[model samples]
Target: MSTLVKEDLFENLLESAPANFTEARQTAKDLYLKLGLPAPKEEEYKFTGITKKLEKSLSNFNQAKPLSVEENLIKESVFQGFEGDVLVFSNGKFLQEVSSTIEGLEVSDILSSSAEIGSIAKAEKDAFAALNQASFSGGISIKVPKKTKVEKPILLLSFNGANDGQVITPRFWIEVGDFSEVTFLDQSISMGEEAYFVNKVVEIKGGLNSHINYYRLQNESNQAIEVSNIETDIQSDARFTSVNISLSGDMVRNNLSLNLLGSNSEGNMYGIYLLNGKTHVDNHTNVDHTIPHAESNEMYKGIFDAQSRGVFNGKIFVRQDAQKTNAFQQNNNVLLSDDAIVNTKPQLEIWADDVKCSHGCTVGQLDEEALFYLQARGIGKVQAKGLLLYAFAGEVMEKIEEESFKNHVVGLIQDRLGSKF
Candidate 1:
């Protein structure tokens, strides 16, 4: 990581960054210099080896060039029957011509706005987040005013173009005001045939008594690599729900952090990852209970086939001041192939005596008894496997509040499994 950063590739990236974020970029660069990259020896990253992949990707990386996209290409990526505002980005740059008009939301350019850009995504914590702050060229700052309730969900579409071996950074900042309610959908896809790297960071502030539901879907090209961070701060009585679905990528890593800053706040994190071929996916989440009476729950499930690999690490921290905190976490995985592998770890750190916290993880294959029972009932072996896998993954999918989105995910899972079975 140090050698890659010292190369001319990083210098070129810095030169192309927007002028308005010069100070922020320099700050991030300095932080990266100090922190470098995490190694496998680190407890948090022991199960995932990302340093080599990141170094190789950054060594040959060039800045993304402007892509000329067709209307049909964008239309093909949009969800059918979605009647909400859509924000599109090509090669990590915002495309206004294809974006829809959004009401009751204030969206501004992050580079030109006076908003505090890196307030929640501090460079001192995560090096990938710092790199995103240093290299991002275009991003948005969205604010939902107090007492406003959005009737439709907001969609953010990010598409990578045909340039091979380029590095792209996407950043976003969102603030949900007091008593507001909104749903946000974030989707990432690729139009390129060659392998590229995407580094993204998102910072969100949930105001007092606000309700925010966030959905993230990643279905990029099999040759693409991605590293993303989502940092959120929840205020008093606010409710924050995050659902993440990862279906395709060569190598994918997600870092999610939630700070329960106020009492009575609630946070829920749910995820499903389906991996095949030689793909690798890693999900790391941390929830900080800083105030008393806050509650948090997390559940993540995965299915790995062929020679694919998956990793899940969830940590919950109950501080001394958080006396009555209630935290629970669970991670479960199923391996369909002999060569497939999964590493799951659920951790709890409690400093208060009055808290109820528990965590558990499991990594195993499908139940043979269930398969035998299904086969006795006239089900084929392959069909039985698919049925069991569907039921295992459906536990997390059923938690999705949006019916349309949940059905869409079910269709994708069916399509992916239908070929294998």
Candidate 2:
């Protein structure tokens, strides 16, 4: 392991962090020192090659300090055709001048209102998560009061400034009160042509009878590398749903886990990734049913082209007391080119006798029979192929509840296909 702790990263930034998070940061710092960084020898990171990727991405990292950005670039980062309050963050500074406030939503950067800041995310176990906790000087916090339903989605836009070889860390904590409903859209953008690394962590808490929907769209630059972790806790009578859409990156790793702590809670996970060139992406997810009558559903699909690689590892766990639990998980992948590769693993562990659990994964090529049928119907070859691939991915897209965001995602996919299908 190399020396990853920079003097500026520790001494300068921690000075500005809120006082309430001191102990958590200290504990994370200690854990980071103890764990160093994960290598291929470690089981969790065997196929990702994250250690080498980080070493290369951070060879001359500068943290992108003293942020400076162009006006037009900020405009480009904003979500187009979306009606919502946009909260922007550049480097570590919250860009309040251009951000908007919602009526029934409480937003803060101080993080004082949250009691689960570090408790839900286990910083002691994962090195990257610990690094994020120790080095992130600022983050965003959102709260929905009891019985208050937010009509519009809240967008969190994060920008990594134009610093060569910099590291950007974005963190978030969200809480929803009982009987309330809300939606959150999270995105990250890179401004410069230089190489950079992004480390992010999100923790969400759902009160009893709460309904929450969270969406993450990732389309980072070709020179960017990232590690993201999302941890959600769902209470009794609450429902939590999360979606991840990844398009571009040099190397990316996403970790998502849901903990159903109360009976009658439900959790859903959906994801799609499109890869080309030499890019690499890995998605790891887990759902834990701790009480009786809990349910979870998960599905992830991928399209790999060129020499790119993809990996998916999903696990569903049912504890001894989690009787009457129902869990399902599946992963499907299509290789657009022979050189592309994929690794998928779907796991299920049950300790209860009266539980229904199922898991499966598939890796294959496009259906030639379907393509031939489409071509026979007067569709061009390119259009036929695009239609087949789009149809394969449309299942996950249908899970999105927001109409405008769904249309935006559809437009992105259509542009990528470059066909009149």
Candidate 3:
């Protein structure tokens, strides 16, 4: 693999694009220069050796004809009863033929919506997010009308390339107007025929008093590699909640960042990950309280088995003037095998004296006492383990208020456990 840097890709992308988008691309390119890839000495990325693991040759790629992915694959990957618009991306290309458009929603391509949204993706503190903006070729742009509330959930489906060493990059931008409410479910799945790499970037803008519920499902084959970034700006009194589920991947890394730019805004982040058979998953998140009277809560849980590895790193920053802020973060993990590994860190950087902020993390195995007690009650060992494991993961699962979606995730977890136990 050639030792290609982000600057090479950034320059090539800018040279190929039109002059109209130069300003936005230049901003991202400059940010990439300011903040290079994280080194091993960096505190936040100490445990995650992403730069070392993902050192592969960059392929000059672009949008292509959407793959002939099966409709059954789409039906099996999303939340049940979700009857809203569907945007499908196969092999990093927009599949408009298979996508659905909602009645009141404006779904357009990223380039098409630039005039109205004024360049949806920005380059600020995140290097990978900036890299995504610089190299992203195609994505979906969704806009909801002001004061409108959608009854159904919009689903975005993405599938990886079906050939070996094929890398697919898909990006998304979702915006909800003032006083609007909507639910978005984005799922990434890989076809089982070959090994592939999937890179995705998703940006969300929540208007004043708007409510947005987002769920991300990352379940691909063991040979797949995934890197996804999601950044959101919350307006005054806006409510945003995201639940991220990571089940299978060869190497999966997620970057979730939220900017509380307006007061009285609320943000909730919840994640659950299950891995086995040498799978590796990482979740890195940042929640910034830039304005006063903002509240944020984050929790992530994981279970690893049979030499699998999981990593969780979360940071909550309370700015100096952001008083009256309430932030809480916790990460917990369970190791089901002697070889299974989990590394978790919850960090809090507070400059405001009046803020209430706390962070904690724990890593351990299944409760031996609970297992023995269940066994004494004539319960099979495998069944008892599944029950205990379910209860361990149930903490974050309870945050899903929608019963149907919650139950569906629970069922998926059970199915995963049934295979091993």
Candidate 4:
């Protein structure tokens, strides 16, 4: 299947959009065309074929249409049953009634923003990120005040609407002030049985000495397709921790990039992907160390069962001027069946002489030694396997500083493994 060129996809929308928006959209289209969908020749995308996966139709979603979801969705989608400010978007349009929780955070509709939003939208280079800015229907903008710390985590839910056979794009921008701290929980869900697509981009900016903990949980139906981008910029002495949990979708693609622009900055990234049946999940991450004395650590693990396929591609780049940089990245996977497949690549490109960078990847099945130890204690084979799987996955979950949140993730993974065992 061949994908449509940007010009062909945007001809009608360009003719109808406002002058400034149309110009921005046209410029974005030109950029995407010039950098056409990245092929294997691209260094960062060499192992992951993103363009081939996006060969499906790029239909424009209806901006004016609002999707109505059942009340139960709100109950099931809540994170650990604790919520502060909740912003919900169904079928890419903001639903205000079901998303009001607390006043600790300020939320605004992205489409209603004034010229300031457009100005910020012009500087992005990601293909999907730029496309979202050019034609996003509606999203939420979250702002945390200076020196303030949110007591509860903010929940951002993106659900597929009742649109029979259409695609949706949801875009969001988040800003954290100096000395502020916040936690955001994002989930993608489906409302009806109809097939849909979600193309989302989330851009975050953390100020000096601030902290931001973000969790992305994708749990859409098997027929749904999702492509997500989470990009962050951390300033001096700031801390950014991102945990991505992928447990749903027919075809899933994730691009997570973190840029350390200040000295003494720290970034911790961890991901756990559980795939089964015929599902395919691909996670690509890039860490850019542009300043001196920055530290970043990444660990991503995948468990593939049945005939599922998993892919992990991680790249860490240390600039020539970035001295005293310490970065470590690793990817590990477990295949439960002989037919299951995993493709992993851990890459490092360093130009600085004083930087410490290391990368390695492992692709195989469960550890026989550990399984045997469990079985020797009178545990059944199914129970023994589940325990070993939990042990292998606990390393990534330990990075979550919040006790309650960490326990919540542990529960989710345990439940999934229990059903299979």
Per lDDT, the best of the predicted structures is 1
TM-score of each: 0.95, 0.93, 0.89, 0.89
Q: In terms of TM-score, which candidate is strongest?
A: 1
Tens digit of per-residue lDDT, candidate 3, span 1-32:
12446455445544454344456766776776
Residue lDDT tens for model 4, 1-421: 1244654554443344434456666676566565555565666555555565544533443332467765687777766646366678887777878777557666777666532343333325566666665666667777788998888777787777446435577778888999999998887777765555576878788899999999877777877767777888899999999998887777888988899989999998999998888888889898999999999999999998998888888989999989999999999899999998998888899999998888998988888998899789988888888888888788988877666567777888888776234
Clashing pairs in 1: none
Better of 1 and 4 by TM-score: 1
Q: Which of candidates 2 and 3 is the stronger one according to lDDT?
A: 2
- How accurate locally, in lDDT, is each candidate? 0.84, 0.82, 0.77, 0.76
- For 1-421, candidate 1 gives per-residue lDDT tens digits of 3434443445676667777767888899888766666665767667666777766645456678657766787788777766678888877777878877688788876666665668887877887887778778876788999999988888888888546437888788899999999898899778766778888889999999999999989888887888889999999999999999999888899999999999999999999999999889999999999999999999999999999999998989999999999999999998989999998878888999998999998888899999999899988887888888988988888877766777778889878776234
Give the count of colliding residue pairs in each prediction.
Answer: 0, 0, 0, 0
What's the CA RMSD of model 1 in angstroms? Answer: 2.0
Rate residue 205 of model 3 by lDDT: 90
Candidate 1: global Cα-lDDT?
A: 0.84
- True-vs-predicted CA distance for residue 57, candidate 1, Å: 5.0
Give the CA lDDT, 0 to 100, for residue 115 in model 1.
Answer: 59
Off by over 4 Å in 3: 1-20, 33-43, 56-65, 70-73, 76-81, 115-124, 162-165, 419-421
Can you give the lDDT of residue 22 in candidate 3?
Answer: 59
- What global local distance difference test value does model 3 have? 0.77
